[model samples]
Target: MAAAAAVAALQAWFWNERFWLPHNVTWADLSGEPGPPGSGIQYPRAGHVFSAFPLALGIFAVRLLFERFIAKPCAINLGIQDSGPHRAQPNAILEKVFTSITKSPGGKRLEGLSKQLDWDVRKIQRWFRHRRNQDKPTTLTKFCESMWRFTFYLSIFFYGIRFLWTAPWFWDTRQCWYNYPFQPLTSRLYYYYILELAFYWSLMFSQFTDIKRKAAKLANYAKYQRLCDAFFMLFGVVFIVTRLGIYPFWILNTTLFESWELIGPYPSWWLFNGLLITLQVLHIIWSYLIIRTAYKALMRGKVSKDDRSDVESSSEEEDVTSNSTKGVLSPSSNGSNRINGHVGSGQWTEEE
Candidate 1:
């Protein structure tokens, strides 16, 4: 906590020196029409710097909770096992049984292993397990796997923006140019669209699937699950709205090298912007439905003791699907190996 506060103080001081310390810096200055690159925009302006602080803080806090409160014990379970071509070594599985009740030696406080009751122990356990067991890959590999274009392009875009913001000549030469494929801004912006849309969909899909995965198993750790979903939903909305609303205007304003095609020759900027808006709108609707389903789960009581049978059945089904996907067990392998019915029976199809 002390370390976090110290870092925050330093960040604030840096921003103040860069922007706020100047009497000219004001809300009006920051909010004013986007300045010609470096001209009016101070490096690490107070408003931009402070705005990023919350985003960074929120990610750090959630990561900490998942590590300490949720992940610690989950590491105890799902012990690392060989998975497949995903990594050089076996990895953790993240999925596990929540409780293993044992009788209290003292018979005083029910000997419940919550460490603290009222908290969703199961949710914590699962969270820890998933994060740990997740396929370990290089940053680029993971970025590519999760997002086809966004990660690398954004890195490039941000790097370029930083460079331009520092270069006096780029800022001074405010003259804009335009021509379609020849326009540098149009091409860069087009690349950004590919990545942003992919990332937005991936994020929404993960949240939606996660909600359904535990809806019927409230005893596992309902409260924590709800909290996780709520947090994700807030970010999801931010991503969808910001991407949709800004991308269009961003493309229109920056694609200076392209000839203003008021009529024919549909520009790459319009194509990308239109597609992103449509996709985000569709995803928003889909997320709304998923949220409604999660809300239903929130209303339920404790995970019923009777649900254990269902839980076990579900686990067996999941194992079958996993094995099938990995080619670990053949369908005709007999007894324990033989899974009846359709090959992809219990699992969601990749098409989804």
Candidate 2:
């Protein structure tokens, strides 16, 4: 009941008219009936966001099916084996310490655990390390997960281009603010908005299993930078140049100042610009990491792992490296926080 009341209060505060429309504008002003009064034009509503919840669930269901039937099959075809990491040896004593207690027990704690398990301290440490690796997602799982996202963004990209190509706002920036908030919500834009929201919802629902590690691939890329120098360098250049160079001056300028000059100050306008600015902040933080990686990479002649995401742990690294001729970059620290410590993923570089 307390939770329910809090939710209700939040909804009320969020939907408050003064926080959305301009001082002279009320919800009623944009509620369909135009001044000419022949046809009623539907404007965007706060309730439209709520409608995305149901669609999001539906999209989530579709994503599960897509991964199972489509993505998994594709991964198998590409020679991505579905096998998981090596299992840790069975030891109830060490398992408890690894789980409820500490993953990496101190030397003294290891001595105590070693006695209970009747195993050497090194054996106990290996067990814990193997246990940690077991939880990490397999390459097959990562491929399937990323494939789902790739399909989604690709579809949305074409859809966005098609919609934008026909819009007056696409050609002329003035069309965006010409009629202001009174502009009617078209069916195409409505569906476009919902599908995008739903795709993100799919990610949020699966965030736990996936650990939502956005930079996992980044670490993989850094593993063999000599082979992927072209791709990795291109990715870094595009990421840094777009976010740090062009975004603040071109995109941010257009969203914050240009929008204000065209539409005048309004609550919704401020909210829209605020979100754009907040996203830019994420870009800046990630940019610093990318730059840091590039500088070290230039000096070291090899790229480092991403410091923004979870660092992979493995006593198996030596064994994994022995199989390949190329040298793997030094592993990043495992104690780092998630990218920006946020719900969604951000970019960052790893260092040895």
Candidate 3:
């Protein structure tokens, strides 16, 4: 609601001739018939800002469809497993116990849980193993996700450089002040802003999906921790440089401070600056969280798992899928012989 009000106020200010005109120019001068060819001014179209919302929605829909149909299937074919069967889900009480207690139960504890759930010990063990595997994303899936983000960030960074390199605001920060609200927003600028906004929106949308995969598991602790650490460092550096560095040093400085010299104090100016500052605050908060995580990694020499992650619900179906694959065996005679030998050894050990 506040955002809507701010946009509306900005629109009102943009269309107001009194706010935009120089001291000498009047509405009469602007409306005068047969004005000198060079005397007329091109007013900014405030309505263009409203177009951003629709563009954002279109981008989101396209991203959703692309991920669901194209990207997901491609990843799956590349060895990424999707959620498994629905019947693998445990009852509510068991699920709650599993989540709250140990991830892996063994010895007497495992037997107790098996008896409580009225399932065989082997089944309980398989469930725990499958649950752990579900929480760990395949290597190919991680690569695909990282590559997607890297591509977007690289493209946007270069595009921003190309667009702003020759701009007056890039050279002389005070130039942003000179035009004030009368500066028309070009198509290039509009697209740039919308794309940046949409990228962040997409990140927020997919955040939950990847949260469980962010930390390393005990099974492959060393290898996974290194990968997690490297990615975290990369993400933190990029975020700090882009959001905390360039944005405040260049964009916010010009819009909030330099522009004030020409525009003076007005509700629209304050509102716009307020929004920019609000974004900066959010960036700071996120950076703080990232820093905290980095500190923990540095001190403990490992990435700590986020316990609040929604892995419990997601692991249920994954367990079923993994268990179903266990029944399949190689058709080769050598494989059959090896499996038979293993089964014979297990039976002998059980009898002893």
Candidate 4:
């Protein structure tokens, strides 16, 4: 494959004499035949990098399976329910019109739709309502998804810090560039890099699924919004610290500024740096979107509800009612009133 060939070429170029060959050592000395006692010479292997790609794929498969079979079931047991069975699907023309134009069809528009579809106005209304509700992910589903990501990010952040804490590069970033490609990739660093890359790849793969679930209408929008805001804030902060802060200050600075002596204008060095820079650029763009959402919330004096995701009718109210009924019973009148107030505020009223 082209990719495999490219990796092979880069590895060949990286190990050439111009990079990392000591003054006394010849290419023959790198044949691993016990050069000298305690010389600490390591003949670098490019296989480690290629092997990590398959390992990353394996981990991704495991995570996907775990989410579907274990996490989803556990979430359901914790009382996360989809709003109920949807009404029969609308015809393609009707669906296209409703989604593209206006979610909430008016009196005259409803009449026109009824005429066009040859269905009762009430049936058309129900179809649109169900269509909208179908887009909103259940509370339990969102909770589990958020918890999974939060746990992964939190663990990886700490793991990365621990792994790099005692490394020479951690203390003096310039050291990363000193030996350059001659420094053999350690197993710890190899796994760390591959796992992190895999996580990002998983995110990219599931992005469409996340978008579908991000419809922003839940049984308890206020409570859910609080969770969403907190998670987004945490994720944004961690991303900035790792991708924007430490990466540029440590990794990029060393490779771009300090590594020139060892790398000596190699195309591989430029390609590798280019990839890191591209990741930083993506992080900046996502950060901007996150900040814009927060800014809009601040300016509006409330979390901005995504009206695009709102359903038109109260058919889904039963799901909210069931959720309330499952709550703990209060003995005192004051306690009952407080609980009622909270539920009332959280639930979607007829007006909504």
**Candidate closest to the true structure, highest TM-score:** 2
Candidate 3 clashing pairs, residues 3+ apart or interchain: none
Candidate 1, superposed: residue stretches over 4 Å from native: 1-181, 184-227, 248-352
Scored by Cα lDDT, where does model 1 land? 0.38
Deviation from native of the Cα of residue 286 in model 3, angstroms:
2.3
How does candidate 3 score on lDDT?
A: 0.61
Candidate 3 similarity to native, TM-score: 0.53
Residue range 206-233, candidate 4, lDDT tens digits: 6766633242222233245566555555
lDDT per residue as tens, model 2, 1-352:
9999999999779778787876677777777645356543478876688788888889999988998999888777766777777778887777777778657697677788778768877667667777877887887777677677767876998998898899977666656766677888777888899889877876788777874434335235234347544445667788889898888876777667766787677777777788988998999888788778777778888755555656655447733433322333444457643322222254334333
RMSD (Å) of each candidate, 1 decimal: 19.7, 8.5, 12.9, 10.9
On lDDT, the stronger of 2 and 3 is 2
Local accuracy of candidate 1 as per-residue lDDT tens digits, 1-352 = 9999999999776545334222333444444434465554332223432333344444334444544454434433424222322211222221222123221122322234334334244433333333333433322222222232223344656956765676543443323322211222233333344444443444443343222222222212223545545544454456456554554445433432232432122334455545756766666665565455445545553222221122222223344454455333334433344423335555422210
lDDT of 2 at 33: 46
Quote each prediction's TM-score: 0.27, 0.77, 0.53, 0.58
Error of 3 at 211 (Å): 8.1
User: Model 4, 103: alpha-carbon shift in Å?
Assistant: 11
* Candidate 2 worst ten-residue window by lDDT: 338-347
> What is candidate 4's TM-score against the reference?
0.58
Worst 10 residues of 3 by lDDT: 343-352
